[model samples]
Target: MRFRFVERNRGFFGRVAVAVAGAVKASVAAIGVLALSASPAAAGPTPDYGIDFAIIGDPGNRHVNFDEGRRFYPPYAHEGFTVGTVNYKYRMSRTEITVGQWLEFVNAYRPYYDGPTNAGQFTSDWIVYDNSLGRYRAISGSENFAANMGWRFAARFCNWLHNGKVMEQWAFENGAYDTSTFGRDDNGNYTDQPVRHADAKFWIPNLDEWIKAMHWDPNKNDGEGGYWRYPTSSDEAPISGPPGTGETNAGTWNFYDVGSYPHTTSPWGLLDGSGGRSEHLETLASSSGVRLTNGSDWGGLVSFDEIDRTASELPISSRSGLRLGSIVPSPPAFVALLVVGAVVAQARRR
Candidate 1:
């Protein structure tokens, strides 16, 4: 009888151990599922900066003719007669880089120009951070408004994004910017142009890229396609709103919230290509080696045909901003699934 009792006790304990182990394995598998669901691969190419990009397919044979200039004025000798013929496909940001996005870059990298890093500098003049609010707010009551910054500053922002915002080094191997190309003076001021890497993941769009994305309509001109006279994707200037309203109007021509003008869109569905803040382009002026800026800003004369090639040397007060372009690969969904499977198998083995 004693032997039988001992055998029964052992069987009960063994069953309990099995049940506990099974529960543990089940718990681990559940955790793994949760991790996979929250993984970055599952989320895809969602940047922390809240910037969205639109894919631009190659629109073959689009060009602008400034020689036979349109209604406003005759073409200047400096303005090029033709611009286009970009064959490579690329992606462009859907909207200008907003003040909110700039704040994110500032907060993360804390660049040299940030007021706190240097004395006698003013933050409010550029961006205002409200500690009490616990949120970075735009000073001009337009958080969605495009950021106005210098060309060098904009270049650094692109570098920050390229390095995943972790590297302290300004230029890293396989990085976006080639620091060697950056010219510096005796005072350590950057005097020369910063050259972008040939294989950069992100960069400011060149003149051809910008024009093709903004003005080219694939179905226009009997399907042969041609560049629009204006960045509104129309030959006509956009109708503006009343004064003091800060809306799109003939008089104000002020920058509108991105995508507010539903009628204005590129062939690839990019908004705010025109009638927003002037965007810095990667193209350099041959005469001055200054970077080009395209499109007219709000509160300025609307001339889609007008190109500010000397925008790089423009004062800080100029309402110039940047838009990013890239061809980064999308996250692989299959890889995420495989990771989940592997995790489950390991848990079962244990």
Candidate 2:
């Protein structure tokens, strides 16, 4: 009987030990799952060339009333008196295309354009070649400055971005442009009026779209929705200077870095819309087939104070820059949570 009791006790202790070990393993697995679920998933790697965009939502079914004559101090008639409306919502780049981003495009498409030799000339005359660095660099002080390119070049840049940078499929195909939609001469000049595709992934913003994004105020006039006189989210003009300087001047060359003036953002929080580089608009002027440019540049006379619009008859020599616009998808809140849950489950399994 004593031997039998000892064996039974040993068997019971062995079973208890096994149960405890199994419980500990299950607890560890549960803790890992809880940790992953409680925390957000790690963000994906940043793109080599990424443009941060601001999502502009529709403002209670309202339209912008744009009239340069009434809004401007001297009653300028360049943009003309017009009422604008945007039916759908879109996203606009927070800042003009930066030198770094443009450089990536030039390096990717240099072989197709004119090989690596002429890559320096692809950006602008301002970009200088550095012998020591063995690469083209924007002027030392203008690293984050907006790129100065023509309308056609800007369009091609959009196409390059759409074609995934490595492939030259969309805009200029087989060492030539898709002439059925884009009109190009043998000399590589855009001969006809450029028309954007209906379902283009990325393109320049049209006049109405650009104006609305710049000035539309959804919660103005007791929430009835209205437009600001200027793009600075205020009736008064924007004061420009280098980033972090709080000085105001009508003609100060205050071309601050992108999104430097958070207070002077548009109604939808788009930065540098009023002061920086004059952005190219896809809209063509009525009389001339040339495209139009909006906003004020660094060097201009009260251009920052007004909704300035300049028609680009000569796009080649123009100091115009580009701000890309796109239609991006926004996932629902619950869907985002589910995505996180799935990621956590996968991590726990691993």
| Candidate with the greatest TM-score versus the true structure | 2
Off by more than 4 A, model 2: 1-49, 59-61, 66-83, 115-121, 130-135, 169-193, 245-250, 286-288, 330-350
What's the lDDT for all of these models? 0.58, 0.60
TM-score of each predicted structure versus truth:
0.66, 0.68
Residue 160 Cα positional deviation in candidate 2, in Å, after optimal superposition: 1.4
lDDT of 1 by residue, 163-239 (tens): 67765755332356654455645764544444567656677777777877777777787986766766666767655
lDDT of 2 by residue, 272-331 (tens): 776667788777654334677777767764454465445564444447778887654433
Residue pairs with colliding backbones in model 2 are 241-254
State how far residue 156 of model 2 sits from its true place (Å): 1.0
TM-score of 2: 0.68
What is the C-alpha local distance difference test score of candidate 1? 0.58
